[model samples]
Target: MTNAEQPETPLDAVRALRAEFGIDAGRVDQIGRLLTGGDFRTVEEVVSLTGTSRRTVEAVFRALEPDLESSGDGRRVQEGRAAEYRCLFGAREPFGVRDPWTDDARRDPAAVAAMAGLIGAAPPPVQALDHVPATAETVVKRARFMLDGFDLTGAHVLFVGDHDLTSLGLFVAGGAPGLRASVVDVDERLLEFVGAEAARRGWDVRCHFADLRLGLPAALRESCELVFTDPPYTPEGVQLFVARGLQGLRDHRNGRVLLAYGFGERQPALGLAVQKALNPLHLAYEAMLPGFNRYAGAQAVGGAAALYVLRPTRRTAGAARAAADDTRTAMYTHGAQSVEASGGLDAQAAARVLELGADAGEKTLLVGDGWPADAPGRRIALPAFLGAPLPRNLQDHGTALVNLYPGFGASAVRALLAANAHRVGLVCRNDLPLLKDAEGQREFAGLVAPKFRIVRRLRDTPGPGQALVLAERAEPEGDAERVLGYMYARAHGKLGNAWREGLIAARKAAGTTLTKSEGRRAIEASASRPDLLERSLMELPLYLFAVLEGDVRRSVDALPG
Candidate 1:
C-alpha cells in the first residue's frame, strides 16, 4: 500500500509505549521521526534502528500490540534483505501522566489501598529510630558480605561521621537482631534525621553528638570493640581523624578501628604521609572499599576511597628482651674478637679485616669497644649482664654478629649464640671472662657443633701492632683476583695501608705466601669496584664476618666469654 493511503497510527499508542517503558523524551522523538520517514514499517527495522536486541523489540511490540490496528494483508513477511512484522494502525489516545514524588501521588488513598491489597500492611518497624532508609539493594548485599567475616553479636559498634544518605541506608541494612549499633556525629540535624527514621521503623538506636576532632567521648573509653569512622574528605581531616581514633583506643584490650578515606594520584603525598604515621604505630591495613563515592557523593570529592583496619602495636616486652639476648648469644657463639688498643685497629682496622675475610673466602669478626652508629651491618644491643631475655624475633642469618654493648655479661654471649647458633664462623674476643668455664664451654660447643664447619679457627693470638684477625672457616669459590676486587670495592677508602699490612702479616702467619704489593693491589682493586663491593660483602663468607666484626661495640665490653 502507498504511504499516505496507509491507516494512521494513533498518538495514544505511542504515548502509552513511552510512559510504560520509561523511554527518554528524546528517544520518543527519534521514534516519531523514523515513523514519519516510513522507516519503521517492520519490527526488524525498528530493532536495527533502535540498537536494541530482538527480544526487547518484540517485548515492546507485544506491550503495544493491543493498541495497534492491522492494515493491508496484515501478514508477516520477509523482505529482500530485511525481515518485517507489520503493526498496521498508528496510536490514537494519549496515556495519563502524573508527578512521581507528589504527596498526593505517593500517598493516594486508592494507590495505597491497591498496594495494601497486593502486599498486606506495611512491614513492621524493625527498630525505633531508623534515621536513614536504604534503597540500593546491591549495597546491602555487599555490606552483608563484609559482615559475614566479623562476629558482631554482643559487640558495641560505633559509626562515626555525618549521617548522610549512605549512613542512614547502612544503618537500616546492617541493623541486626540483638546488635547494638550507634551513630556519632557532630551535626545535630543529621542525628535528628536518623532518629526520626529509626522511630518510624521501631528501631532502638543511640545517637551521640560530639566533635570527633576533639577526640572520642570519655564515656566510650575501652568500651567499643569496633569503631567505624568515615572522616571528612580533606587530608587534614583524615589525619586528625586517624590520630584521634587511635588515641581513643588506647585503653581497649582487643579493640579495632576502621577508617575510611579518599585517595588519588593528585594527592599521593598525603597517602604516603598517612602510611608513615601509621607504620610506627604498627597498624596494618586490611581491605579497601573502592567507588564508595557513589554513596559518599560530593563528600568523597572526586577521588577513590579506601577502608583501613587497624589494631594496637604487636611488639611486647618479651620480644624486646629476646632481641637483646639474641645479640649477646650471637656475639659469644661467633667468638667476636676484641681489637687490642695497642694494635691500633680502629674503624680502619675493622674495615680491613672485613676485606681480608672477603678475599680469603673466610669470615672475620671485628669487635670494637663502641657501636659504629652508622655501620652498615646487623646491629645487636646488649644491656646489663642478663638484661631482659633476648627479643623473640631474632633469627640466625648464616654469618655476622655486630654486638653493641651498653654494658656486658656472660649472659650476653650465651644469648647471642642461643639466638644465632646456626650461623657459621665464630669470631669472638671480649674483655669478659672467656668461655673457659666448663658450663660456658659446653654451651659454646652445643651452639658451634652443628655449624662448626663454617668456623675457621678456635682462638689465635694477634702479633704486636696487629689489631685484627682474618679467620678462614671455609675457602670462598672464585679467583683470588675477583675476590680481592670485591673486597676492595666494599672497603672503599676505609681500608688504609696499615690495615692491609696487618692482613698480609695475618695471611703469612696462616702459611699463605703473598707479596705486599699484590695484597695492596688486591685491596685497592676491590675498593674501586662499586658493583663488586656490595655483592662481595653479601656473599656467604664475607657477609658473616663483616656483620659480626663491624657491629661489635662497647655493648659486649663487660660480657663474660
Candidate 2:
C-alpha cells in the first residue's frame, strides 16, 4: 500500500521508521515501546520525550519546515491545506527554526501588545539590525563619573572599538570640557556608520583605521592622555585583543588606560591579569565604567569592565634618597605647625645675621634696592650677588653687618656667606629657588653654615616681601664691638624707611585722616624702635592699605643722606 494510505499500529510504525532512517537498535526499540504505550504519537509527542519545554519544541519543529513547494506550482502549499492543523511528523515541517531567538514573520499586533505588557515595551525585532543604542541616562551617569574622577578637562582622549552608542551618550551628557576624542576601529563599515551618526549630532569625530591584531598603530605614541577601549570577551579574539591593548599603554606617560571588559564573577581575575601586565609601568587599575552589561546582549561574557589610570613611576637615586630622608624629617619636625609654634626659629636664625651689621660700629652703609616700602625694621635689601665675593664694606663690618634684602639671588647668597663668615645675618625670601632644590641643601648650607641665626616672618598672608629678624651675639671679638654699633645704625636707617612707607600707605588706605607728612613722621619714629615698627607694620594692612589715600604727598621730603 502507498505510505500515505497505509494504516499501521504504533509499534509497527515506529519500528519501520527506525529501519528507514538507520536509527540505532537500542533507540529504535525504546521509541517503539514509547509509541506502543501511547506515550508518543506525533513529532510534538516525540519532542516532549526529550523533556524540553513546549515552546522550545514548537520552535525546533518550526525550524525543520520546508522552504519551497513541490514543483510546477510556485506555492509552499496549496491554499486549503495550508491552514489545516496537520500532525507533527506529517508531510509538512514547521517554520522559523533558523533563528529561534527572533520571529521572522510580521509580528501579530495582538501578540506584540501582549509581549509589551511583560517587558514594558515591545523589543526591537532581532532582524531590525542596527547598533544597539545605550540609554542616555546610563551614558550620562557613566560619563560624569569618568570626567569627575579623572579630571578630564582639556585632555586628549582616544576611543577604541565599537562603543558608538556609548560615545554618543557621552556626547549628549556634555563630556569633559575641551576634550578631543578620536575613534579607532578595524571595521570600515562600522566606522562609516558611526561617523555619519556622530556628524549628525555635531561631533568632531576623527576616524582612524586600526588593526589591533598587529599591535597598536605608531600614531598612538604618547599622543593621548586617556585611551578608552571596549573589547569583545569571546575566547576566539579576547587573548589577542588584550595583548595588543596592553601594548598600547607603552606610549602613555601619565596616561590612563580604560578597558571595558564585560562583567561576571570571574572578572576579577581578568582585572588582576591586566593589573599585573600594567604594573611594570606603574599604572593603577579601577572600575571606572560600571553596569556595562545591560545592552551588550546575552552572548557577551562579562557583565562589567574596568579602567586603568597610569602614572610614571618616580625613580629614587642616591641623591633623591638622601633628599627624601631630609624632607621626611622636615615634615615630621619643622613643618607648618612646628614652625608656627616655635615662632619661626629657622627664620629667626637667618634674621639675626642680617640685623648685626658687617662692621662693629664704624660707618654703617644702609642699602635698599626694591625693598618693599612696607617691610619691617629688622628687614634689609641685599643685592642679588649669590655667587659673587662678599663686598669689601660687608667684610669689614663682618659679624656686625646685617644684609637686609627683600629677596636673595645667587650672587647675594655667595657674598653673605663670604663677607660675614662668622656673624652676618642674611635676611632673604622663603621663595629662594635654591630652597626647593635638593631638599634646600644649597639654601641651608648658604644660610645655616656660618653660625648666623636665620629669622623669617610668618607667611600667614599674601604680601610683597618676607620679613626676617637677625641679632648679632654680644661678645668680645676682633673689631666685633665696633661693627655691632655700626650695624645697629644701618639697621635703623634702612628699616626706618621700610617701616615708614608701610605704615603710611596702610594708614592712608584705611581712611585715616593722618596727612602724608604726619604718616612719614610716624613711620620714622616707629623705625627708631623695633617693637613699635612691628606693631605699626602689622596694623597698617588691617586699618590702612585698602581705603582711599586723600591729600597724600607723592614724594617724601629730602632727609639727610
Candidate 3:
C-alpha cells in the first residue's frame, strides 16, 4: 500500500499485520515499540520487560530483520532509520514534554512506561458492566494527580471498579509498596486478572468481587481513606458509585473521592443532571479538571472525560448512606440492562414466581428489585438481602421469592445462596445465559450446591421471555455440615451470632454442652473481629468466606466432646 493509505496508529498496523502475516501481531507491536524505544533491549530484556514469550520475541526479530541492528549487548532499530522505525513501531514518550502536572518527584518515568506497555494486557471492556478502558497516559496522569493532591501514605485506598487498572497505575506512579490498596469489582475475570498482576509484581493490592448495585463488600464499608472510580457514564451509575465510595471512607469529612466522568458536548443537560444528583450527597467540588482523562474508546463523548476531586462534607455521611439507587438495573447504558432495563416486575411475572413457591404453603418474603405493587410478603431489597445484616429468625422465612435477574448480573449465584427458605423461587428473563447451556447449568449448580438443590422447572414457560429457578434447602449431613447449615440458614443475621450459636449447638448435639461464652471465646481466639461479627455470611468475598468456613469448622472441632 502507498504511504497515504498506510494505517495511522500502531494498533491499526498490528491489526493489518496480523491479518496479512498470521503473526502474533500484539507481541510484534510490543517488541517493535521496545526495539525503537531509545534503548537497546536485549531479546531477554524485551521478554522480561513485556512478559512476551522468548520464542515470540525471537520470531518478531526475524520478521523485522531488515529494520533491526545489533551490538554486543542488545538490539535496536538500525540507527539510520531509527526515527522511521520508531513511528512504525508506535514508540512514543509516555509523558509529553508540555504536560505540567507530571514531574520525576510525582511519578517515575520507568514505572509509568512499564505500566503503559502492560495496560493493554487488561481484558477488554465488558459493556454490560459499562466498562470503558482509559488510555495509559490518562491512567498515569490520574495516579500523578492523586499523589500530588493527597496524603496517601499508609492510606487505605479503594478502586471501586478497576477494569481500567488504575490501581496498578497508582503504584506505578509511586504509590508506596505497603499502601493498603483494595479493588472491588463484579467481574470475576477482572478480579482474578488484577489479583494475578498484583501478586506477580508484589504490589500489595487486594481484589474482591462485588456488584456495587448489590452492595459494597461488608468488610470494606467505612474502612478506606481514598476512593478512585470510573463508573458507567450514566447519572444513576455515577451517583451509585460515588455513594458507595463515600460509604467506604473511614470518615467522609477527611477523605476524597476522585471521579472520572464525561458527557457529550451536545448533551450539557445530561452532565447537569449528574451534577445535580451529586448535590444530594453533600460533596464539595474540590476541583474540576475538564478534558483531564483521555480514553482508548468512548468516542461519543469525544474520547475524553473530566477528572473530579470531591471532598465529602460531614453531612455527606447521611446523604451517602441514603443514596442507594433503587433502579439498579437501569444504571448500565448497554447490553443486558440497556434501554429496556427497568426491571419493574409486572403482575404476571411476579405471580408466576410466586406460584412456584405456593406449594410451600408458607408466608412470602420479597427480595431484590421490582415486585408488583400487590405482590405478597414483606420486602428486603436485593442489595440488603445479599450483603446487609438481616434478622436471624430463620423460622420466620417461610418462602422467599427473589429477583435473580435484570440488573442482578453475576451475583445470581451468591443471591440464591443468600436466601434461606425450604423453597425459594426467583424470576429472571427467559434467556438467562446461566441456565441456557449444560456447562453453565453445571457450574451454577456446583456453586450453590450442598446449600440448595436447584432445578429450572421453567425457561420460557410463561411466554416469549421469562424463566424460573427454584431451589430447596438440602439436609445437613455431618457435624460440620450441620453447623454450616445452622449459620447459613440464618444468613440474614450477624455472622458471629450465627457462628457462635451454631458452634454451641453443634457441641450440644454431639453430646457436649458448650456454653455461649465458651463458643464466643473460641471464635475470638480464632482471630474473629467485631467487624466480622456484624457482617452477614453471604456478604463476604469468596476468599473471606472460605476463611470463615475454615474458622467455623475449627471452632466446632475445638469444642469439648
Candidate 4:
C-alpha cells in the first residue's frame, strides 16, 4: 500500500511525520509511544524524554497541535497541580508551563515584568545590524545561569556589548552589593536607556559609547574581573568581540570570557569557521553549553545559540596589547552593504577619497570606524575625544572630513581642534539628525565659539550629502585648561587633585620611572583614598591639570617647564 493510503496507526503517524515534517526518528518514536500509551505528558517531560531543547520540543508540539486538536480525543488535562497535554488513545493533557524547577524559589514577578516591559519598549532591531536581543525569558535564564558561577558581591563585571540587556537582568537580580557593571556599545539610544535604568535603580552601572570596530575604549581596558559579550554571528565579528572583551579583563591569566554564538545543524561549516576564529586568540575552550542562549526572531539556528566559556592562555595574556587592532571591518551581517555613504559617493568611493586624500598630502584622516581596512588613509583611531595629544603637524590648518557617526560630538570637535584642522567638514548620511535641533546647534556653538568660526551650516536631509566647514580664527582663545580637560577626561574618567597626589606617591614608591599602566596599578593597590573609584585612578592627573586651576596647574606646569 502507498504510504498515504496505508491504514493510520501510531507508528504510521510517526512515519508520516518524518516524511512530511522531517521530524527526527527518535522524536517520532517518542511521540508514537506517547500516542500509543495512555499517558499524559508535560512539555518538560517530552523535552526530557527526547533530549532536545525546550524550544525545539515546543515547536514540535506546536506543529502537531492542529492534528491533535482535530483528533477531538486530545486535550489539555490537569494532572495533580499543573496542566498536562493528553492526546487520543490515552494521550495526556497538552503540556502547559515549561518551568522544570518546581522546587526553586519563585521569581519576583514585578522585577521580571519590569525587565520584560523595558525590553519590549526598545526600538525594533535595525535591518542588517549585528544586534538582536534574546527573548526576555532567555535573558532572565541567562542572567541566573551566569550569576551562579561567581559571587558578584565585590566584582567588577564588564559587558562588551549589551544588546541582549543581560546587564539589566543582573542588576535587577540583586545579590551582588558592591557590584560595578559597565557597558560599552555603539548605539547611543541603548546607552541612554541603560544609563537611565541604572539611575533609576541606583545601581553602580556605567555606560560608555564606542564602536568595537575601532577598538575598546582605553578607559575600559583592564578594568573588570569578568567579561561578557554577544557579538555578531559572523566569524570575524565573534573574534573581534572576543578580543575586545579579553582586553577588559583585569588579569588575563585568570580572566574569563563568556561568548555567545550559534549555527544551524545543517551549517556545520559555519560553526567550524567560528570555532577556527577562536584559535588565534589562544583561548582555552573551557566549556560550551549547548542551547544556552535563545532568540525571539532568529529561526535559523532554531532560535538559539550556545554559550562558550573561554579562559585566556598565556599567549592571550602576552598578546593582549595587539588584540584590538587585529579585527577587520567587514564583521557585520551585510559587510559593506550596511555602511552609510553619501554625497554622491558609494562606500567604496568614499573610501577612495579617504585613502587617496591622505596619499595626495591633503592631510586627510578618516574620522570613523567600519571603513574598508584596505582603504588608504590612516584612521584617527580616537573612539572618543580624549586628551591624547595630537601630532603637531595635524594640529595646524588642515582639512578634516569627519564621518558623522556615534562618537561625533565634543570629542570630534576637540580632535579636529587639537589636530588643528583648519577646515572641518562633516560627511554624514542624508537623514543624519546632527543640526536639526536648536539645542544641539547651541551646544555645538558653545563648543566651537571661541576657537573656530562656523563658516557654514548646511542642511542636506533627503539629499546627496551635507557639509559644514568650521574654520579656525586668526587669534583663537585656545582655552588650554578646557582643551586639556577634554583630552584628559575623554581618555580617563574624573581625576582630582588628591587622586593625582595619590598616583604620584604610588609612582614614587614604585620607583618614579614606572610606565603609565604600572603606575595606575600601583595606585590601585596602595592608595587608601575612598574619593576615587578604582577605575578613576588614571583620570586624577587630567583632573589636576584641567579642573584644579591655580595651584595644581602651577604645580603641573612647574614640573616640566
Give the winner by lDDT: 3
| Model 2 Cα RMSD, 1 decimal | 28.5
Off by over 4 Å in 1: 1-142, 165-171, 247-254, 299-303, 314-561
lDDT for residue 369 in candidate 2, whole number 0-100:
39
TM-score of 3: 0.72
| Ordering by TM-score | 3, 4, 1, 2
> In candidate 2, what are the lDDT values of residues 1-561, reduced to their tens digit?
498844354334433444544522333333223333322244334332322223332332332223213333212222333333122233322211222111211123333232223223213322111123232333444454456557667666666555434454445546667765666554544555555666666665545444343234434434566666555433323333333343444444455555554333323564455444334333344334333323323222221233333333343122222321221101111222121222222344433333443344443333333323332332223321221234554544333333333322222333333233344434444454434355654444433222233443322112234333343333323222222222222221232344345444444444544455664654353232232232211111111111112111121222111
TM-score of each: 0.31, 0.30, 0.72, 0.64
lDDT per residue as tens, model 3, 422-500: 7778767666556788887776665566478786557874444667788888887777777777887676667888888
Any runs in candidate 3 off by more than 4 Å, and if so which?
Answer: 1-109, 113-121, 199-204, 325-327, 339-343, 369-376, 387-395, 430-433, 490-501, 513-536, 542-561
At residue 428, what lDDT does model 3 achieve?
Answer: 72
Residue 85 Cα positional deviation in candidate 4, in Å, after optimal superposition: 14
Each candidate: RMSD to true structure? Answer: 28.6, 28.5, 10.0, 9.4
Q: What clash count goes with each model?
A: 64, 66, 2, 22
C-alpha displacement of 394 in model 3, angstroms?
9.0
Alpha carbon lDDT of each predicted model: 0.38, 0.36, 0.73, 0.56
